[model samples]
Target: EIEAVAASNRVEVKPIVMCRVTQVYETGACVYVYYGVNFFGVDDPLQLFFSIEQACVEVMLRHGAALSHHHGIGKHRKKWLPHVISTPSLRMIQGIKHAIDPTNVFATNNIIDT
Candidate 1:
């Protein structure tokens, strides 16, 4: 995936199969994990603010595969929902929800914020 990005794909186009690593495998099975850490430093807090938010949301999304088959659609990734998910996929699956309810009044547990 990183290689594809370096090749100037603009957006991450790889279809990733992610699973949190809780147990080690004894056979030839492969474990695909997005190992991440929330790093905070006292330096340049103003800049760190956005970076921290982005990283935090990403971690949460990665933790909950129920939100997305590959990764949870955290708020930070919402903006790119269009990119990661195909337009047709979005329209076919999500368009109705947003159209009939722009206020997102039906959203119960999902993150819906300004």
Candidate 2:
């Protein structure tokens, strides 16, 4: 999938897949796959890099992977949140966020938006 994305985006690079050599914790069946895009030179290449990376993320999400593996859902990935999580779950999360950060100082953008 990564290769296909790269090809379609005209990114001349190979996909790099890395796995942990040791177990850090017992996550059971959950495994997080991280995709990093590094490109040098011009602005167009950088933009293409981001586009391809987002495509990779879409593929992962379609395959039942989380929108994010480390950090919680931020503004950039919020569009896909509704598809991944239920409406009730999102409302509950927003309630918790409001209870904890009522002042909206956490800066999650539209992450808590219903």
Instruction: Quote each prediction's TM-score.
Output: 0.38, 0.68
Best by lDDT: 2
TM-score of model 2 relative to the true fold? 0.68
lDDT of each: 0.46, 0.67
RMSD of each: 10.6, 3.4
Candidate 1: what lDDT?
Answer: 0.46
Worst 10 residues of 2 by lDDT: 21-30
- Segments in model 1 whose C-alpha atoms lie over 4 Å from true places: 1-19, 22-41, 52-71, 99-103, 108-114
Supply the global lDDT for candidate 2.
0.67
Error of 1 at 63 (Å): 18
Looking at model 2, the pairs that clash are none
Clashing residue pairs in all predictions, respectively, total 0, 0
Q: Residue-wise lDDT of candidate 2 within 1-114, one digit each (tens)?
A: 766766666555665755443324564344555555444433476666667667767886788767765577677667788878899998998888899988777765666543
- lDDT of each residue in 15-101, candidate 1, tens digit only: 233456444456423334452222232345444445544554455457542224445665645664654556788776665676677
The residue ranges of model 2 lying beyond 4 angstroms of the native Cα positions read 21-28, 34-43
